[model samples]
Target: MTFLHSFEPGGVERVALRLHEAWRAQGRDARLVMGRTAGAMKREWPDLNKGGLGYEILGSERIPSSGWETLWMIIHLPRAIRRIRPDVLFCAGNSYTIVAVMMRVLLGKACPPVVAKISNDLTRSDLPAPARPFYRLWLRIQGRMLDRLVGMAPPMRAEIGTLMGADNARIAVIDDPSLAEADIQRLAAARAEARAAPQAPGRRFIAIGRLAAQKNFGLLIDAFARMAGEHDRLAIIGEGAARRALEAQIERLGLADKVRLPGHVSPLDAELAAADALVLSSEYEGVPAVVAEALAAGLPVVATRCSVSMEDMLGGGRFGLLVPVGDAAALAGAMSDIAKLKFDETAARDQSRRFTVEIASHRYLALMEDLARA
Candidate 1:
């Protein structure tokens, strides 16, 4: 059996890499096709090459002003599919779902069973007009061709099912995976190392994600400023296009000393374990893997009610504090409450149990077995 995984950089890439390793460990022939930042991939995962995985870089050519990249992707997808000739194709990231459908259409019987992982909530009609039609078209096509649709959260499953006109029963909820027990121990040791060092003695808040508008780091910075004198420092990890704007905001808030933007942190589990609390200030999410990791470390989370998945992940405020989107005052209040908040560490760990790497891998393998038998 062969598994061909496609994903862009970010959380999807992280999850895909983990799944790839799991499949390979089980003696399945698995390869990863990366599109986006190959440089970042090398930096973040130096061991990828040593893992015996094949990679095909896409979207590298310069095109004209008419934004021919989309055309180019559609044009080149068929060739990539034919070359890979995988027994099963797993596409990660929402941006790549349409491409996966197109490839399946081009290959027909030669193509393997395609599974598109839906990682975002699509219930909201916030998508632009042009995107709505495109999404509909892709969904209509995928509904007939794709063998399975995978989602991390129930809300994501519902949204994708509704969009594709597929039965909800056809969609599978495979929660995002967590680190192995050994890796968790390593993470704990790393946290101990961070804690043992002679660092400043103030509340340390961390926001992890790209410095992009979608992450809404600007709102996080503004919220941090509201509690500027109360907390010693705030760290925003992950770099992106909005770095300069966030830097400007930090300078404007006069928080240069209090806030730091450490770019693209590898081994985030360590940093999360050391943090006083984990903050998710995104405009949207599909059951963020980082949130699960934070909870696994027993860290209190202060997040915006960014997505329906957040409601389920946080268990309606049982595990963490949830605030309204873009509301700095409410966020400041929630951040302050972290000192007095009595969170059940066992409950947090229990909630994160569903996302274990072992569980997700087995679930996916079972699904593949069923598909093969069918």
Candidate 2:
């Protein structure tokens, strides 16, 4: 059983949907369990509902669209676990992790062991002034609650382990199994389209993911405005509440003609591969799929040092350029310099191998079997 908050089209949802699909491909039974909270991802879930690899969309919406639905999901999950009786339960991201752990407290021994796939590095810095210590305590709770906590990279594992102490051993390192050959082929097509793209400017630069505060796309726009290329255009894909603020910032920067917000595009491999380089200005990440997908698609990256995983993935500034988080001038300078770089396609793809789902499955399957037995 895979427990998810909702069927949203974010990285966590995408990974959960694909994980079950991958499991089904291996002739295993996998089901996606979520609340009936409607959103953009609902459109994609139907296609993933292949014969026999069916999913359960349980319960009615109590709060419909906010963080409240996540609470409802947690409350309803224990009952669903009792009904389905899955041998091992898997929680896709941080939100679902809490739900998985809470099941034991709510439903006692009836709930199965949970395997949480950690997707973000939530530190004291993420919380408000009064909540920092509470957030730290919450991290410890998460670490103690799960049967296993999965991290995307060694750095991610080490960071979380240090934060949670001995329970850190329970944290396993696994890449986001969020891509397949189909995604790669689609990216190749996008790359081809990009190579033949119409006249633009100095170079085509792109950024992917939700347009939220965490993504720090506003920072990217600021850096882009400072960049001195009349022809250099930046495209930020994906959508969120920050669209209005971002649009206003773009206009304020006088980059209306240079930057475009095309919203969320699925299989953004081509959009990524078509660009001269992919820029990431996020405040933090849990092994961002865009960075991994871009590298796999042979796209060079210019990213802020948001997480250790980002730096570790970039070979500590060897494969691509990295700047301090929120440093607009340094980010802009790196973006300007890195666009002129000719990165080796083979090496770029090779570096991205750590995040692929195919490679991640071997580790996930063994852990699942062990947890199920225990």
- Best-performing candidate as measured by lDDT: 2
Separately for all candidates shown, the number of backbone clashes (residues 3 or more apart, or on different chains) is 0, 5
TM-score of each model, in listed order: 0.86, 0.93
Candidate 1 residue pairs in clash (backbone atoms < 3 Å) = none
lDDT tens digits, residue span 1-374, model 2: 98776656689888877777778788787777767646676666556455633777767655463557667777777778888888888888886766777787887888788888888876525457897777788888877777888888888777788776536558898877767756666666677676776855588889988889999999899998888587888999988999999999999888999999998776566577668888999888888888878877778899887777877888776678989888999999998899567577777666776666787766888899988877
Model 1 global lDDT (CA atoms, 0 to 1): 0.72
Give me the candidate number with maximum TM-score: 2
Candidate 2 segments exceeding 4 Å error = 42-46, 61-67, 196-199, 340-342
Tens-place lDDT digits, model 1, residues 223-309: 888876644688898988899998998899899889999888777776776688888888777778888877777777999887778
Relative to the unseen true structure, what is the C-alpha lDDT of residue 17 in candidate 2, on a scale of 0 to 100? 74
Instruction: For candidate 2, give the lDDT.
Output: 0.79
When summed lDDT is taken over every stretch of 10 residues in candidate 1, the lowest stretch is 1-10
For model 2, give the 10-residue run with minimal summed lDDT. Answer: 44-53
* Cα error, candidate 2, residue 8 (Å): 1.7
